[model samples]
Target: MQEERRVVFIGKIPSRMTRSELRHRFSVFGDIEECTLHFRSEGDNYGFVTYRYAEEAFAAIESGHKLRRPDEQPFDLCFGGRRQFCRRNYADLDSNREDFDPAPVKSKFDSLDFDTLLRQAQRSLRR
Candidate 1:
């Protein structure tokens, strides 16, 4: 069986942090397949960041997975199983709870190739 390439991040998501920031933080280790932050409550929340390779995941685990920005709190990290989660789970799990789930902050640049992006940029300049 293929090993799961995911690491569970246990910590509180700072009010300013977004999924893209979290994903970028892990990219140094390897290519990230997906990064989802489950913002449960105010005190503590959890998220799963899946890498493209088990070795990448292992590297992250070995490094202690300590993420530190100049102005953010460190998250507790560990190897966790690959469990699929959905956005609806938030509502289903607790309807009354107020959770601040930040949307994934990916720019159009992330999806566009350089040529396509350059064309769009030129088009914009022409207008």
Candidate 2:
């Protein structure tokens, strides 16, 4: 099986940082497939840099490359796994009751009668 591409999570990133700047900074370590910065309105912003090769991602972490600005403290870096990134944290999971169950999703199409569906399709065509 092919090895999965590596992603590095950078925490405490400045909200003003741009994709180009991140790409330039990590490019020295290896070819970067993508760089994404997640900006939050009420919390600290973070970013993820994906490398084309897994070795390059490991090297970048091992080298201790810090993302710092002229007068700001350096940002922290760590290897990010897909599961860790996607899964909810312990605190969030624990807040919910053990018996909690999400309501079944109902599709709009399923609830609409044939006449309503036909009218909606006609209205869409008019636009």
Question: What TM-score should be assigned to candidate 1?
Answer: 0.54
Q: What is the C-alpha lDDT profile of model 1 across 6-125, one tens digit per residue?
A: 654546566566788878887888988878877655656666777888788877767634666657666667777434343234333334546856578898589889999899989999
Per residue, candidate 2 scores C-alpha lDDT tens digits across 41-111 of: 76577788888899998877776445466765577778864654444643344233687665678997998
lDDT value for model 2: 0.74
Q: Give the lDDT of residue 91 in candidate 1.
A: 33
Question: Model 1, stretches more than 4 Å misplaced?
Answer: 64-66, 82-127
Q: Cα RMSD (Å) between model 1 and the true structure?
A: 18.6
Q: Give the clashing pairs for model 1.
A: none
State how far residue 105 of model 2 sits from its true place (Å): 19
- Residue 34 local lDDT, model 2: 78
